[model samples]
Target: MIQMAKQYGRQSPTTPFLMVRCSAPATWCFFSGTNNYVWESFNNPTDTILPTQVMGLGGMLFSRLTQNNYSRGRFELHFSNEDVKLYLVSRPDDHYYRFEMFNATNASESASYQLVFNESAYINIVKRNGETVPLPLISWRQSTFAPNSNNYYRATLDFDGVFRQYAYPRMRSLIDGDDQSWSVVRYLPDNICNAFPDQYGGSGACGFNSYCRAKGGTPSCECPPGYTLMDPNNKFGGCKLEFPQGCGVLDDELKDPMESYDLANISGLNWPYGNYEVL
Candidate 1:
């Protein structure tokens, strides 16, 4: 980002701005004396957003490549119209989830809208008048979390493509042995497998050759027999065949294809995406 103290490029504004701030995820920003922000990070978002921040219309939240990797991933949440749509980037305009707003807006009126996940964990698309255009996300459930303590909260588009709100206890508070891990307050597209019934998208909730199953509001991906995870450290990264079987193989192996490649049964399994004929 270029910062010209006196001017921006060849053009100059009526009043020369004094400061610049970048409120970003992973990357941080700071400010002291209050003068309106000529630019702010809230307007521009990353994979996660704090509860108080708002994402304007046409804003998007992109998924990360993995839990530890910050590279851009394949999932996207687009706020463009009456619905907050989640799309698979590789599959183009086909959105897996369509969360409808509480109230519809008139096409003729000019209005500005912003999306926010309030302190209580309610995702709303609100108008300037404080009217909530509810995206019909799950209702806010009361939690025992104490912000005054070391509790922290954030809603993130996870690596596995599930958008979730998590509350973590930064420092231990309880005397008894308790699970102080980040707890999921809410998540959407409840059933990841059902979201990708048709095998067409590049990869559904999980990666290719892996299937998605909701395990406590999170998508748990697993590889089947004869296949192993591509990256064991990152299970959601998908899997690949353990043994290569093709024309490149020896003639003996090709001749006894049935003996070399035996059928393996996986009950109650749903493949993310594949040809219907193969099912």
Candidate 2:
């Protein structure tokens, strides 16, 4: 399509802004810019990918700093190779997501494929010869309205490193003007706490000294008793010691070590990268 766009006359700058604003730009079959399609939004995607767009090999999606902050976040999904691995940049050496896209022994399946998500709420593997394999999603929400005409779909790599699919209805002229809302249709790694294993190079789901608890598919970071978060604004930010320890404080330990020290005995907590045998 890049080669074909070269043969067409040059397009005005406004033409791109208008076409890209369309609900389904793919259905319009309009190439954004005539400049060899170089300066196109599709070529440079932010966090969300619209329907009918394919995330080809080597493509990557970086999340926002926070849901409210649009700057680049610590989490990223780099489709670096065919296996389709996604690593949490907080721990670059470790990856949190993976899936094999091809079958080495299955001769019937095509090797060249594209990951496509359309009006449907799930992403699928489309082969060059029209063969397809539907990826497993937790659940397909029964559409409350006509999806193809009334709604638009998007898949986003969220701030906290969870991939979610959303549906937005065209509520330009709604009976209830306040009904404009984006509904979450699907999300990957349903259990956010389990995304990062117990044995870790970095903090598991939350930062060091912070407990990661899953509340309705979202990871909630909390400080255990006797400790406080480093930053109240940042929940995932590591926790800190409330006071100085080891007998070097104003409230010096006059008694013996055993008598002065009392263990917090917090349950369900583990050392992030501690070396300990299960035996």
Candidate 3:
């Protein structure tokens, strides 16, 4: 792809943008610029986050991923369950990037960015912070160019998952160049986890639990208390009893006998049985 870009004079300032389509699910794509800007797209969204873009909040930036096949990568960046926390996940690698927004309070906010494809591609996020600080910056350089106009670029992912670049062109309007220029588009493919429900533990959900599979979909049943994933084959198979022998056993030390006994305990306990084991 790099060779092609060079052939078209994409390396020069005359070309403002470049667009690349995916193998399938054409909803998402890659955009790049002569100035070293890059971004991914999902048709459009109520809010969007672009690649190699900075979103300031205590000197941080939010970065987007390139399309694996004409769609957003399965990996996602989200806030942690803890107060003002954040995390990045891709399949088994959950919380790949984690951090706290603030140590002082629980205040939260949400917004989106956009993907612009011209001579270059870039994802832009809205500025949420009003106070200015001397934030660190990074630069992404084109590694190679092909005759077909395909090019490769690289950027760094900060500890907070914010991206910074020093050489990329500033955000511009599809019609006019403006710092605040942006537009909301429909989301391509529409759903990010099209094939992996268990991984997401249901849409808009996060975290690792006995009922959530690191690979896909939500577990149908709850894991036995005090126990977590027991079978590696089926992550969402539900948790198993920590100690099978302890099932139905009551701790006599408890002051209340009835309260101390669990589902495993009862004088004439009738075990409800089924193919409860998920492989």
Candidate 4:
């Protein structure tokens, strides 16, 4: 694909964009800029997709380790195939969300389904019988920044394992000198914490000993009192106890672990699972 894109770029250096379609299994189709600005594959998705991209029956989206690392993370988004539904799975193979929980799945006996974000950014799961249904909790709010921004919409399976949609304005091509400007319209998963249900054992919701919250329309993680970051570099790695698990000696016991520890009660904080024990 890169070679083809490069050849096309050399032939039409001034062209704004080129859409390439192929029959190979590795890539179905892609859009490449005449220059070097845009390169998006509708099939080779890592963790993101633009509106109108079709996630085929066997297609998958794998999250990244960190924001910077592109290697496969512990989370994945794929068609369940079992019930023709879309599911997001994390490490330990726990299912977090059924991304496509449409009523159509249960109504049809189709063995497979296709997922796609319409040009207007509406998520739909298409059954083999040609029935289309909208994903649950979809956002219908119109985009104020780019009223007709269907041409530039994005949906990503975020590092936090939340699937979200975003809109971008149609702006002038970097080299084409054509006028085109657009911005984000609307996104999904109204509440970040809501995406992480408590039924999945909280294995992929967030790091252990950490709290998950939504701030500025995004998921944020933080450690509570009496604990510090386990890996200061990776917040998702979880937190470590500031105090030792048990005193090893009389001298260790003499030094009060609770001297610096203060009880903290956080209200409205969301956990991947319930804090109360089943007992």
Candidate 5:
């Protein structure tokens, strides 16, 4: 709701127009003029989940984590509603990354990949056991941003998740290929900051803080191993634990309050007799 870009900067232009407005109702948005990224997901929108996206829903439905400002938090992930199977949650705690979704009508021939939007966006999409494999069709070009001029672009995914992409130039700038110079063929995957960090760690295996986005690509983080950081502002809370344990309470003769103990003959215990008789 607020997508504007009409020659606002000027870059090739001859065909590029994108404009969208939403009010929220199972919100879902995705726009990528090939490198200008935008992916918004609020509620529901089956099929078309990008950005290190993972989907496997047959029944059980429970994937929590809403209150960063969305409201609250604590649902984590529950499945068992009937038990279907949909994993792909990795972070400092909740870990998962199982996949299953590549049926294709009945299964004869149908696999696809190549999901790159802009700024080096990424999401190669590759499945093996479950099938689905054959992705490579993202390629685009035509934005020297100056020549014949006639370009307009848009990509949005904002309900709070934040995802954007924009471009403009509808009445100025044109040089090569003329006709108002503005060409964008299709060869995406190089923009989203230079996507590659396990493709945002969707299934690439969460590492830093956890983030894998698609509108193009470029979103990385991962930190879990004894924790560190204190607070860069709050990356989930910046992690903590680095080794600090001591709540006290342990002195009953070294505290052993056993409930049961009997390991055979014990007399100053020094057991481990195998071959030794040198007296």
Candidate 6:
């Protein structure tokens, strides 16, 4: 990660500005001072943010390529169309999944300027002069995570593009005297499917042809029969249909048109984007 930061076209970039690689998730860029710290936005933020920081105009948060890969992914968070929104980057010129701010319709001048996470844990859209504006519906939850006033906190865009808040509690240690420990306190959107629905070729949390189901408060993917996983190693990549595309040309007697397909019906499944179609 340090090597990648060095290659970012800056000469002799050192501490106070560092690229930290976590053992579990993706890499992160951090900027720290004597009493405060922040995630330095180099125009490319991968899957996270600190509560003390601000997401200003043109600043974007992107998810990782996969759960295991640290590179950039297809999800994005940015200010656009007179509001702050979350989108899925489909094509270079195409973006989907727009979750826009509800209360900033009259304040376009201040709405897209900067998003601030005040010390009170309120995520607000504000102007250059620090005038607070309304935020998106997803960020309206009350944050009751009251820790020590000196402790640090972070709001990260997770691997699946879930916006979450984490707290680092300050405590006195026997050897270190003063320290902080990390813990998650909040996550937004509530459902992964609401953020990543099947819009463009099953473009949700579980990819195409797969459904997102919550099991024990965690999202899991499942593909219908007659289809198999596209990448066995990456289960979230979705599945591929096993049947032939065009008409079968084989001359064998068992090659009947009806015999080549398998029939299975899903009962309780809710179709993506909306409900079932009318007959």
TM-score of each: 0.72, 0.71, 0.22, 0.65, 0.20, 0.64
- Please, what are the lDDT tens digits per residue for candidate 5 over residues 1-279? 333445668654444334343354334465545535365553232222323333332212232222234432221222121221223334323222222334444322332222222222222333333433322332222223222224544332222122223344556534543344323323223332232232233323122333333333333333455556555543433346566433332442343435223233423312123244321
**Model 1 poorest ten-residue lDDT run:** 139-148
lDDT of 4 by residue, 28-112 (tens): 4435554443544665788887666788766787777677777776567776544222234434344544453434346345345
**For all the candidates, what are their Cα RMSDs to the real structure?**
6.2, 7.6, 19.0, 8.8, 22.1, 7.8
| TM-score of model 1 vs. true structure | 0.72
**What tens digits encode model 2's per-residue C-alpha lDDT throughout 1-279?**
323323257753343312333354643323445523224566567777877777666678888877688888767876533455556676776777776666534533433566776555457767767777665543322323234567778888888777777777766545666565777766666666776766545666667777877765678888877689887777766799886667633465365767645677767765654555531
Clashes of 5: 43
Q: Any idea what lDDT model 3 has?
A: 0.32
Ranking by TM-score: 1, 2, 4, 6, 3, 5
lDDT of 3 by residue, 28-90 (tens): 454545535365453332123333334333322233333122233223333222221123443
Task: Compare the candidates by lDDT and give the number of the best one.
Answer: 1
In Å, residue 52's CA in model 1 sits off its true spot by 1.9
C-alpha local distance difference test of each model: 0.68, 0.64, 0.32, 0.60, 0.32, 0.60
Candidate 3 vs 4: which has more TM-score: 4
List pairs with backbone clashes in candidate 4.
169-182, 169-183, 170-180, 170-181, 171-180, 171-181, 172-180
| Model 4 segments more than 4 A misplaced | 1-40, 82-94, 99-112, 137-151, 172-184, 248-261, 270-279
Of the pair 1 and 5, which is ahead by TM-score?
1
lDDT of 1: 0.68
- Which segments of candidate 5 are over 4 A away from where they belong? 1-19, 22-62, 66-84, 88-108, 111-249, 259-279
